[model samples]
Target: MSTPSYHPAAVALQAVLALANETEREVADRLGLNLTDYRALSTLSQSGPMTVGNLAVKLGATAATTTAIVSRLQSRGYAERLRGEGDRRHVHVSATAAASRDIMNLMRPLMDATNRHLESLPAAQQDAVAGFLHTARHLMQNHLNTLSTKDTA
Candidate 1:
């Protein structure tokens, strides 16, 4: 059998993913958080305050596991749970100001590195990269949803 042709785009995508994973690991270590904890905090930072059930769904974690994650964050003073006034059962988890600051500090280096690379690109190339990433994210989300449904079945 002949060797398959190598695609530069495919190789670049793989390298980008590997670098991102390494960045995540570095940030998590700097913040003294496990990968799951860091991911939960990252999600909370992006999505703002959300109920535990909603967070669990987002994290693909069970209710018990989510609760434990929340508890850990709460104990570390990184997060807090707010109970609704009218509906006490409605609990929402939010990152504390300190947690947000810490996360930002931990991520600043990676963000700066990525920004430097992006800034070096021409405007048109930057736009093209952004569009490609947006489409890639959407496609990944669709694939994940399909796999999730299959696993549940």
Candidate 2:
């Protein structure tokens, strides 16, 4: 028999994920980078150097996947992995200057569009939207943490 139909919630979530990924991927493809690399570069641009494990967690990805992303970025000269001087095993990754500029340039249009759209909303509504996004992000993080814990148990 065919698989059962997904619930309404599942369908909505699938659509949201697909839409967001499709939009981001399209932009990234044009910029010669995948979503992972773009996200990693953006994160590094904001947060400076970070451990691979921390990067993986921040990216909501596995270490192996993040490692692959770091490897690709390294190969492209967009990022570098640096070992801490005092701690030999402490490895950190950061974006190259070129990568920082590229991400900002690539995201400029998206940022402008988002800002314009948000500006169209009433002031209170814009604040509400920002609050909602913050809460949504926290909720998603909690859900991911639960899933990860369950998966490895």
Top candidate when judged by lDDT against the true structure? 1
Tell me the spans in candidate 2 whose CA falls farther than 4 Å from its real position. Answer: 1-16, 59-68, 83-90
lDDT of 2 by residue, 39-133 (tens): 88778888999999999989988999999999998998989999999988999999988888877787788789999999999999999889867
State the C-alpha lDDT per candidate: 0.90, 0.86
Report backbone clashes per prediction.
Answer: 0, 0
- List TM-score per model, in order: 0.87, 0.70
TM-score of model 1 vs. true structure:
0.87
**Model 1, residue pairs in steric clash:** none
List where candidate 1 sits over 4 angstroms from the true fold: 1-6
The worst-scoring run of ten residues by lDDT in candidate 2 lies at 8-17
The RMSD of every model to the true structure, in order and in angstroms, is: 2.0, 4.4
Candidate 2 Cα deviation (angstroms), residue 89: 6.3
Please provide, for model 1 over 3-116, each residue's C-alpha lDDT reduced to its tens digit, 9 standing for 90 to 100.
888788767877988988998888888888999998998888878999999999999999899999999989988889999889998899998889899889877887899899
